[model samples]
Target: MPSMKEELDQSTTPPLCKTGCGFYVNKETRGLCSSCYKADVLKKKASSEVPKILDVNNNVGNQEPVENHDQSNKVVKKKNRCHVCNKHVGVVPFSCRCGESFCRLHRMPEKHACKFDFKAAGRVVIEKQNLLCVADKLEFRFFKWWELPDMVFQSYHGWENWLDGLRLKKEVKDYLEAKIARRKIV
Candidate 1:
């Protein structure tokens, strides 16, 4: 018969870790070994503590308003609450020309029945459509600097009648020239 020690050694099963660490671990432990599980638990505890610290700092600083900070933050928080639902809004929230900050759900002036001028809105739409039509007419047309005077005269009736049809007033021409100069430099 085999010796008692040899029989016992043969019957004993090797320890195995659940995390595939190739190390011996207690059979009752799940997933990670003892050391890895402890480390993981410590990491989770640290992350949770960090968020609490951040929340504390944010609350403390915001509780009392500072002069150097954005005054709009305080104003928006207090007065610019959503006009319809009275909910607080963040920075750059949509505000109607009628002087009210509206949440995404009620951002449109018509949705809130704002007293905006419908005539002004119609004028703006007409102006935009006119601009689009002008852009479409000039889309494929290209002219060099030397051809500018000829093109302008031809497009209008002639040099003398150019001022009648052409809308380039002296102030507008100066502004456009300045803008073109700035664009060239940039």
Candidate 2:
């Protein structure tokens, strides 16, 4: 048998605790150190007591039925129905500025005849124009070749411009016709 001094030395050597506490564990307790075991007991006791406290507190409230109280505490979302359709409930409803909810089919203000202020809508249009202007440089070189014919025609014709506004120069029209003829012949 080891002597008392030897036993004392072994115990004092700081072996790893099973509870991952980083410090040496007490040898008297099975695997767990005294502090960890006490913590575990306290945690279990707290968990068990929580539900009992809730139940007691719930019963002590006013004279509403238990089922009603349970349901009332829970947030029950009202199903959104379309103002126009009045039948089908929407999963993803669209809300208008006019304070009316709508389905996908009648979400637009025009579709529902909503009385939204036109001044507010004009601001959105102006913002869209500003965004387009910011996205492209206003230099003459950046102008598209396709728009050149229309721009030239519109400047001279003014009120006499065609409804489609696709007037091409006489030379360009003749060239396109010749190309189409050549393709057909081949």
User: For each candidate, what TM-score against the reference?
Assistant: 0.25, 0.24
Root-mean-square deviation of every model = 17.6, 18.4
Q: List the residue pairs that clash in candidate 2.
A: none
Cα lDDT tens digits for candidate 2, 93-144 = 8888888788888889899999989788899889888864445333333334
TM-score of candidate 1 on Cα atoms, chains taken together: 0.25
What are the per-residue Cα lDDT tens digits for candidate 1 across 86-128?
A: 8766776788888778888889877888898878989999988
RMSD of 1: 17.6
Task: Report the error of model 1 at residue 99, Å.
Answer: 2.0
**Candidate 2: stretches off by over 4 Å:** 1-80, 89-100, 124-186
For candidate 1, the clash count comes to 0
Error of 1 at 171 (Å): 33
